[model samples]
Target: MHQLNSLEKRAAIALALVFSTRMLGLFMLLPVFALYGEQLVGFSPLWIGLAIGAYGLTQAILQIPFGWLSDKIGRHKVMLLGLSLFVLGSVVAALAESVYMVTLGRVLQGAGAIAGAVLALAADLTREEQRPKVMAIIGASIGLSFAVAMVAGPLLARWAGLSGVFWFTAVLAVCAMLIVAFLVPKSVSKAPMAETLALPQSLAAMLKHGQLLRLDAGVLILHLMLTAMFVALPALLNQQHLAAERHWQVYLPVLLGSFLFMVPMMIIAMRRQQEKRYFLINVLLLVIAMLICWQATTLWGLVLALLVFFIGFNFLEASLPAMVSRVAPAGQRGSAMGIYSSSQFFGAFLGGLLGGAVAQQFGFVAIFAVLAGIGLVWLAIASTMQVPSRAQRLSLPVAVTTEQQAAALAAKLAALAGVQEVTILLADQRCYLKVSAQQFELAQAQSLVAVGNQ
Candidate 1:
């Protein structure tokens, strides 16, 4: 791997902080909000579920648009604006007395859909060789924030209350805004190009791609089950043996143990050549987790089942973006990732609403059964997929001082052996290439580009 420059490392850290702040705000609410929501006046169980999912609903609607807009506007500018919106939303939620008001705050919170923009910006800013590593760093930060939030959120909720949690989120948002404004280094934004996809076309094409659809469906269903299960699981645990106050003892161990399992799986998946087999086996693990959760009884049994669930969850959560990098047509990757993200949020929304109702009526067993059914359907779809082969994620590098030179270079690179796809923008001073590993000849290709530079 090529070493990252200082600027690239700084950008990665800054971006990770921004992502973590946004995620912490959203995740902190999940552990305790729905249950307490019911105690508040005028709050129905359905409404509490809606409140839980409201951010995801709006985020799903706008993620693509925001990504497209960031392409036109400066990414940093869009990012700062989005962070400000998040702060505003947090303040609104913090002061709200009614369920409707809280729902509105959640919607506003989702309006700050700059996470995609940030990732796109990072891709734009970093070297192709370094981008994956930077992406991994940002992803790790998100996972860390989530685990910490689950354990910490309840404590803060107890100490400062949920409203206080929102207030803290608002402050974090301000910190994000400041980082975007002052800490992040400048880079050239993407100029409009013929190959760059429009919002509508991007969304439509993404939906039609069968592989991406399967992955998107899996995420939506998985999260829906997750949100809905949490809605009822704690309360159920209260009935069986453990009190709500001691729930973290269960969550902490399960989450930590799953990480232990996840590390080795990741090493094997990354190093081994059988991407298809690994992918399928991971999906099967989800099926097993669903079954375990379906039949869980003792407090320790619930923890064990969750351990299995996280094994599946962590594996899928990390792998989906890598899949997106492979499956999305090179030029439209930004918008494709945006659509993928929106689907994740929408899953959260649907899970909270539908999962709650199912559990309320038929009990938690039915909830797990429903999740298992969804996973089984996904596994069938996944099994049919021809997982993209392990190979270099193709991106072309070029240095040029003129449009004429860039056009000539682009043509020469496209004509080279192994080059399957090429996208060039003379205005942006960049090239993106997709070449198959079976056919790739990097040394010959490098010599060709070197001639263009001279």
Candidate 2:
């Protein structure tokens, strides 16, 4: 935080708010979609699952493209386009009269792909030393959004229904657009071209990087579990004759109770320097919870299972990115994050669709069994992963503009003391370095920036 200027902090907070508002619109339907989805024309439980997770599908496909586009067109410009797409999709969803149309709307909704763009832009504006603080704010916003959705979605569904919720999201999209235009300042980095990355290489680069792939795998599993549960949760609640309006009573307690357990473990992992051990244990717990959920017959049993479930879910959700931020190549952080994010949305889509089809035909028990199986496999893989301490990012402006000069400067910066990784972009005139924060202070990094300029 000492590294971040006032503008950077404000932008980070504003971006988080915008991101959460949009994400909430997507998740608001998750808690109770099954109740209303069945009423629309041609509503099969599986189709209903698609409608709920549709946005994720499009988001998954487009995030890397959008991130790359931002590198070429500027993050703000790319973000505005994404936001407009969201507004358009929201309108389509709000107007949908059938399940098929709603699915179309969801795909359109995901076309926004603004989240990656916004994150990239935030990184562009702030110093690397401040990113964790910035990311922490965004992460908190996401957790809060999930908590708020659990409390608010059901109540809103009772009053306005899914169409109404989409309309509300459409309105929020408009609000986010205005904020992007006027409130967020335009960013222009002065770093010489070599460190900043191109958008087109995002996906390919992420695919090839083993360290980043681990994080991506983790994200995919997390959302796979999330969407799978959401697909069945409402229908299960309905079996108890709980209306959409009343589902929150169950959600509220489960979410809150889980956080009580989740927060302490997160603290212990970081504070006690037991991140790898705790992370692996968390995945194992997820597997156990899934098995418990499969066997739950009473609402109390379900509630207990959910507490265990979210403790695993939320902890992984919080910790995965921090791990990626630490281990990914410095020049490729934006691209790595782009891939990680895409996997999350993709998992949501696949999870929802698969969970629905499986649950609709085989039974809810089968769905949990499948999810548990996946969790166990993921846990095994994760236990074998290299758990590296987080590496910090440092950005500096460069005076050179030509491609050759950018490459030369990158080499020079790479040779500098304590720099572990380097990325330089001639076009963006930016250079990014991954350095040991424990070994290098903010003032030292800043001084290096000055030296690079000279």
Winning model by TM-score: 2
Please give, for residues 342-426, the per-residue lDDT of candidate 1 as tens digits: 8889999998787667766776568778878878887888887766765465544567888788778878888977776676655
| lDDT (Cα atoms) of all candidates against the true structure | 0.76, 0.79
Model 2 ranges with Cα > 4 A deviation: 1-4, 188-203, 397-419, 422-431, 441-454
Quick one: best lDDT, which candidate? 2
Cα deviation in Å at residue 96, candidate 2? 1.9
Measured by C-alpha RMSD in angstroms, how accurate is candidate 2?
A: 3.1
How does candidate 2 score on lDDT?
Answer: 0.79
lDDT of 2 at 432: 74
Q: Can you tell me which runs of candidate 1 are displaced by over 4 Å? A: 188-202, 394-415, 423-431, 436-439, 446-454
Looking at model 2, residue 184 earns an lDDT score of 78
After best superposition, candidate 1 residue 394: deviation in angstroms? 4.4
* Residue 301 lDDT in candidate 2: 72
> Model 2, range 67-121, lDDT digits (tens) per residue?
6687778888888899888888888888888989988988988999977677766
Error of 2 at 56 (Å): 1.1
Mind sharing the TM-score for model 1?
0.88
Each model's backbone clash number: 1, 19
